[model samples]
Target chain A: MPKEKAITAEMLTKRFGDFIAVNAISFEVDKGEIFGFLGANGAGKTTAMRMFCGLSLPSSGKATVAGLDIYKDNEAIKQRIGYMSQKFSLYEDLTVKENIRFYGGIYGKSDTYIKKETEILLHQLELEAQANTLVGALPLGWKQKLAFSVAIFHQPDIVFLDEPTGGVDPVTRREFWNMIYEAAAKGITVFVTTHYLDEAEYCDRVSIMVDGVIAALDTPAALKKQYHASGMDEVFQQLARGAKRQDN
Target chain B: MKQFLSFVKKEFLHILRDKRTLFILLGMPIVQIIIFGFALTNEVKNEGIAVLDLAKDQSSGELIRQMDASRYFELRAYLQNEQQIEKTFLKGQIKLAVVIPPGFDHQLRHTNKAQLQLIADASDPNLANTMVNYAGSIVQQFQSTIFPQQQAAYQIQTELRMLYNPQLKGAYNFVPGVMAMVLLLVCTMMTAITIVKEKESGTMEIMLVSPLVPFSITLAKAVPYLLLSIVNIISILLLSVYVLDVPIRGSVLLLIGMSILFTMVSLSLGLLISARSSSQQTAMFISLVGMFLPTVMFSGFMFPIENMPKPLQVISNIVPAKWYYIIVKSVMIKGVGFNAIWKEALILAGMCTFFLAMAIRNFKIRLA
Candidate 1:
């Protein structure tokens, strides 16, 4: 039997006045898969992620995010899918514990559950001593890790992370991936966007978007072999060099 | 409800930690009240006057005495000539000059018609107007004493009483304006900045992605600001009543009710600005230059609407602060009940509904 799908998009498209951001692109995310959406700047990877997270309305096409229609009841979809943006979405002025508690509370987590889970998460990061410190004082790696934790605090059916690990040191990026892997292991579907092509190797499946169209969709091995490239970086470079779109 | 509480709590933390916003939140109302109370005034007290009394008779002496004790004038000198009167006025030692002809007593006793010329410096128009009125009233009082039962021709005995502001303290006039201004600053500028700051930081997207509806999200963001603005209202009222001696002449309940309505108007204005702006800098610019400039210029704060030109007066009707200023003045200064101010109160409520609907509509489009 085929695996359960968490998100389904058919010809999903978005336009800004005359500029088409996300062209008609169709894809499916499995229930427990770590799907990587790869693209260069303004390739419309973020736009697709926005549609899945119900942040923007699709100019055309249909999508079911976390098994709910994006158009008909996106609010219902919002409750089942967590989201983290390119910028650090947590309030920097709030303490580490405060940021966690606030996100947890707003997501309808029981107070007792938040208390228990917060303690466990703080211990796992060895941040028990700094729980009361504002997130702004934390180093880039710690803040990223904490941000990812907050994004999944609700334990939604799926979590969409748009450029979750940008501008971090190599070691921290690897550690952030480890956390992502850990989350995926718990049966939570992870749909993430990143420009770091090397990170694409870790996804169960990868899709390359060029000018609002998904040019390729397959496992890393299949995509690399089809493109006759040694790695995802080479495939991305070849596809991006052929694209006719550019935006910041 | 729990989610809203947490959202509000986080909003409070954001506001309390931001030093610049915290200063504006707590510091502006007190400073505005104190500044308006002491520095800006229209009352002319102890203004110097010179009388060129040629008669030096009983009637002129009594007229000078009455003017001297009226608390509005200080008798500077008894001028001798037309040159001395001009010199006294030019030197700025006296704001008013009274000229009594030599036949003043003879004319008043025999002809029953006397001409007393009053010359007031017109450089400062408001002061000059007040001084002229004060001197004219005193002359009328002097005439009344002379002709207690004679009923002089063309003499209309006028008994004037200034209602509400019995002493005509300028502070009474501004207390309501200050209240309106403080609420506008706290609600419009401050709320718009905080909301746009969330959008700039991208935290608003995170919250939107949560289960909370956009309406609750905006409302939750506003709850803390609403509470802070209320605190500002109380502080301003206390400062106005106790420190400045400005009385809340009407029912305190009506005054508080109007304050809440005005604050809601300000909050909706802020929501409208926040919906239009995407960055804190843009929101601050729009909120400051957009909301406040009109509020101060046309809200009847210092410039009375009745005296403003027709177009400006029409524009003033659109400013919610203008209505609130009128309502507050009527309730706090005029000592009027709800019946007298229901029209202004209705307009403010309608504005609150319109802006709120616009904000919600804009938010829907953004989400879409």
Candidate 2:
């Protein structure tokens, strides 16, 4: 049986003035799958994600998120999806508990639900002692973890993580991946974009965008075998080098 | 609405945590008010004068004595001749010199009209004009005293009643103007900077991706500043009424309602600035050079708009603070109600609507 589409795009494009940021791209993310969006710096990954999240409108083409029209039902779609940006998006001035409460409240969660979830979240992260401390005073690793947790605090159907673990220790990055896995276990679709080829291997399926176009999309193992590469890293390098050769 | 409340609560926490910002919000207004009230003034006193009495007669001597007795002029020295007048002024010791021509008493008694040459330093034109006026008033008083029977010809009777501030107290004028200025600075500039900070931090993108609508996000950001500005207005009113003895002769509720309206206008202006600026520094610059300068300069705080150049006076109409200042003065000083200040109030409300509409449109364009 074919996978159920959680997100769909058909020739979606975004342009700023005369410059095209995200060229025509078409893809779909299945429900409850970890979909990795891989791209080099300035390959238009962020722009595409922004369009998918309904923060930016496509210059042309049609897209739907969670079965709702992107343009007409953006608000409804936003309520059903979580988003974490490359920068840790939590308010640095607010405490951990306060941040959770704020995000939860914004998602229209009840006060009691927020209070209960706050306790559970703090306990799970082992950050109960630092609950009242400001987020700015926390370490970067902890901030990244807390930001991921806050993004999914409302238990949305899909969580969009835009380069979620950019700067962290290897151990912390592994631990953050465990959290992502735990969310996926609860049947939450994880739409992630990252530069780490090793991290792409952990995704159920991955898509590589090169020069505003998806050059490759498949399971990491399948992609490596098809490209005759040793690992995901070699596969990505081979695809990028092939694009450069074609341009020449 | 729940999302907006949470966003507003977060904004309050941000403001509370930033100690420097809090100090600027609460401290700058009071400091500005005190400085303007005490240190800045248009009134002049104790100007230095030199006497050049070429006619060494009793009447000239009496006039010199009268000039010395008056508090407005301080007798610096007696000049030797007309040539010394320039030297004395160049030294900067005296601002004016009285040159009594030869045979001054003889001419006054014979012709009943005497000419007194009053030369003044005109480097600072305002001070020069004031000094000249003071000297003329003193001479007229002396002439009246010397020839009371000739008052029919030299009759110059005038009654001066300084309305609102009988003593022309600086606080009476500055308190309300400071209220207008501080409210504008805190409400508009601070809101713009905070919103721009969010954009710089990349948190605004995250928030935008959430379920919150653009209107909800902007309205949330505006709420905290609106509340804080109202509190600031209260503090300013209390300070003016209690500390400066500047009474609010009109209804307090009306004053507060007008303040809130003005604050909305200022906040919308800030939102407009934030929508255009991509960075915090750019927002700060726009607020300081664009909003702050006009609020202080043309809001009847430093320079009276009526006394300004006609073009500048016309330009002040665009500044929201100008209308707020007039409304405040009418309510606080003139003891007028909405019936008298309705036009200014209406202008402020219209400006608020226009700014808010522009901000909403800009937000939509940015999203697109």
Candidate 3:
């Protein structure tokens, strides 16, 4: 079976009254592809991500995610997609098992699926003993690992992870990418945002957002060769600096 | 509905898991009720008094017995001299001193009148005034008994009819306002903090991205606090009626209904505060500085609204607790039905709706 497009946006824009936070931007992602979204602070990457994730409506744009309208079928889009923010937004007071059941139930997954999937997940992650413990007691690495597992537990078509591996040790970051690779191998589209340029090398395709517009979107190696930059970090600095000095 | 129930259950777990907050939530009202009920009454009891009876006669001794019989005065010492009386007052041992001049039975028989002096430590003006009036009334009674032939027509007697609270219990004044203050603190502070907590921890973002409608999210946040505030009202009612001897003169159902309406107003106001604040500390600060003080000061809880400056009296009209205090007093103390308190009740319900609408607007604006 031929794979289809998972995400498509055309001239998507978001404005905050006097500020055009996300100027007209557009992009597309193929199914089962791991797409890296790179941007500097205040580059409007978050605003565009919010528009795609249905957290905010577009000021003017046309977009579809998981084959559903971003404007009319926002609720439907929520069920087909998963989002994990940088803050690791899990209930610290709730036990690990409770958080799993809570997210599963919210996604409208069946009870039998939740039970069967929860057991498999606990065993696969080697967290059976800690399943009943509050997530607050877990170390940062373990919490992030658990959060990622829960975020993808419902088998979403596309999972939007906004800087998911932020603030973790290098070894843990490597292991977290292994999990992302594993999810992609299952034919789930991985749409991620990250500032760690070295991690950008792991993406199948990279889109660098500068000043609310996509300055570059292609394979990292192709972009590196095109810009004559030996590393993804240099490539990012070149694009980021261009926008800062644009109007000046 | 399932989503809302799960959300409410999660909130309850948060409430029950934190032992310190649980202690505060359950402990504060009971402690406040006890403090206001037993410790802060206006009626004087077991106050100390000293007597300086220079006359070694039957009439002087009769006056002393009259004072000792009343519940208000406890005779502390029979002073040997005026110096002894002043020293006793300085020690804080007695609030009042009654002096009988040396001519007691002889002067009463010869002149048909005896001069008596009453000395009071007026440090606490209210207590001192009440004690002196108590002593003066007892002396006047003694004089009347000793001389029946003298009923002066020119002597004006002040007939004080304490209407609702005949004994003038301060608990009568405080219990209703405590309801206002407690519900305001519990519903407003708790709901505000709970909502801001989700925002601060970044969980609100995830919830917003999920399938739950904003309305359901709001209702879910409000449900647990609503139930808890209702429990608060009942506990306060139990404490006031059984423990404090405060009567619920009107229908029990009506009091509960008014309480529920007032709590909704408090909860929506809390939601409004939560929508404005981004952190728990800011929400708590607004709840305390904004809602708590106004409820205490302008609601006529501690001071009567009639006595406040005209400007403050006008400001008091905007405080939801001001109307709630009136309803509590009317339905609980005055025992009047809904007909009498319908206007206050309607105003409170209107405040609830107005706050709810404003909170929804604020919340949606922040989300967008």
Q: Which 10-residue span in candidate 1 chain A carries the lowest summed lDDT?
A: A1-10
lDDT of 3 at A11: 92
Worst 10 residues of 2 chain B by lDDT: B37-46
lDDT by residue for model 3 (A1-248), tens: 12278998889999889788788888889999999998987787777788888878899989899888888878888888888987889999999998988878766677789899999999978899999999999999889989899889889999999899889999999999999999999989999999899999999999998887899999999999999999999999998987762431
- Model 2 scores what on Cα lDDT? 0.87
Tell me the TM-score of each prediction against the true structure: 0.90, 0.89, 0.92
Runs off by more than 4 Å, candidate 1: A1-3, B48-70, B75-94, B97-117, B139-156, B308-312, B365-368
The candidate, 2 or 3, that scores higher on lDDT is: 3
CA lDDT for candidate 3: 0.88
Q: DockQ: which is higher, 1 or 2?
A: 2
Instruction: List the RMSD of every prediction in angstroms.
Output: 3.1, 3.5, 3.0
Looking at model 3 chain B, report the run of 10 residues with the lowest lDDT sum: B359-368
iRMSD of all candidate structures: 1.8, 2.0, 2.1
- Per-residue lDDT tens digits for candidate 2, residues A67-109, read 7888898889889999998887888889999999999988889
Best candidate per DockQ, number?
A: 2
A85: Cα error in model 3, Å: 0.9
Task: Give the CAPRI rating of model 2.
Answer: medium
Better of 1 and 2 by TM-score: 1
Whole-model Cα lDDT of every candidate shown, in order: 0.88, 0.87, 0.88
What CAPRI grade goes to candidate 3? Answer: medium
